[model samples]
Target: MEEKSWSELLAEHSPELAQISRADGEFLDADSALPAWVKQLMAMQMDAVFNHPHGARWYGRRARELGASREQVVEAIKLLRIFGGRPAMATGAEGLREPSE
Candidate 1:
């Protein structure tokens, strides 16, 4: 079976919810003192700490694309270990693994 795009899945579930999510994303993505990459890294850390591995990976990849270094990502994961413990650190590390292109 083919994988469904995020929009497609959201549409199938709830278009209104998807629209709200997009709006919230746009609001959060607005200009700020922090750079885009920093924001992505912050999101990754929060996701990892919350046990949201998929979000952690996605934000980590986005952070890299926005000019964050691997070392930066690793550091963020390490910092989160205090709050999230070993399991969270392990899950966050999944972002380090290359995803299939």
Candidate 2:
């Protein structure tokens, strides 16, 4: 089988995706519930942030603290938006993680 893009997965399972992204009472256990591919994509995105300039270092340091790769953090930034951030929401639904309050 071929791998699906994050967006593809999100579109296919939008409601379930929303539930997981919302971190609602039901989303808290997402780690076990979400697909492993989504987790991997999230991790990859976190690592990619180190490539950025402005807050790259700060993000890198924070990524270390969070135990997520810089790419994963980057990915989380996107995901956070999709789950509940701002207008950027539509852009990164693939690896979206329901933001934690």
Q: Which digits, one per residue and each the tens of the lDDT, describe model 1 over residues 1-101?
A: 99998878897899998898788666546547887788888899898778899999999998888788999999988888776687767888889987772
Clashes of each: 0, 14
Candidate 1 clash pair list:
none
Model 2 Cα lDDT, one tens digit per residue, 33-83: 664434544444444533444334444454455455656656676775554
* Model 2 RMSD, rounded to 1 decimal: 18.5
> Cα lDDT of model 1 overall?
0.83
As a whole number from 0 to 100, the lDDT of residue 12 in candidate 1 is 83
* Regions more than 4 Å wrong, model 1: 1-6, 28-30, 86-101
Each model's TM-score, in the order given? 0.64, 0.24
